[model samples]
Target: MSSSAAPILLLALAGFLIGGAYSTWKTLRWLSISLGACAVLAAAGAILWLR
Candidate 1:
């Protein structure tokens, strides 16, 4: 885990969570789906960072 990567990883995770929540609340089903997908990608990136 390089120091440089930490911020980006954290940002991605945060964005994913925030976007997912907002999309879900906004009642836009398609956007919610997209946001969920982003969340998955963010999680994968986090896992890769840990490795």
Candidate 2:
């Protein structure tokens, strides 16, 4: 993978995780929170990777 591609992939993964969290919020609060945390981590990773 290219260096630029890594951050892009991480951001995409973050978007997917955010969507999963939102969808699971009604019936699975714990899972949603977990997903949200993961999404935040992924986003942070992407930002850090870009720097």
Candidate 3:
């Protein structure tokens, strides 16, 4: 569970960034956050499969 927590925390942080970007109307920031979320999900999936 500890091992899984890091990527989940990252995903949550990226989600917050996305929300903040949306509020500020920053397109690049939103895009970066979207990518960050995707990366986090991928990493989490990989970790789950590996485990």
**Candidate of highest TM-score:** 2
Q: Sorted on lDDT, highest at the top, how do the candidates line up?
A: 2, 1, 3
Q: lDDT of each structure?
A: 0.72, 1.00, 0.62
On TM-score, the stronger of 2 and 3 is: 2
What local lDDT does model 3 show for residue 13? 62
TM-score versus the correct structure, for each prediction: 0.57, 0.98, 0.47
lDDT of 2: 1.00
Candidate 2's C-alpha runs over 4 A off are none
- Predict model 3's lDDT versus the native: 0.62
Q: List the residue pairs that clash in candidate 1.
A: none
- Output the worst ten-in-a-row residue range by lDDT, candidate 1: 14-23
**Residue-wise C-alpha lDDT for candidate 2, range 17-36, written one tens digit per residue:** 99999999999999999999
Candidate 1 residue-wise lDDT at 51: 72
| Model 1 residue 7 lDDT score | 54
- Residue 37 C-alpha lDDT in model 3: 65
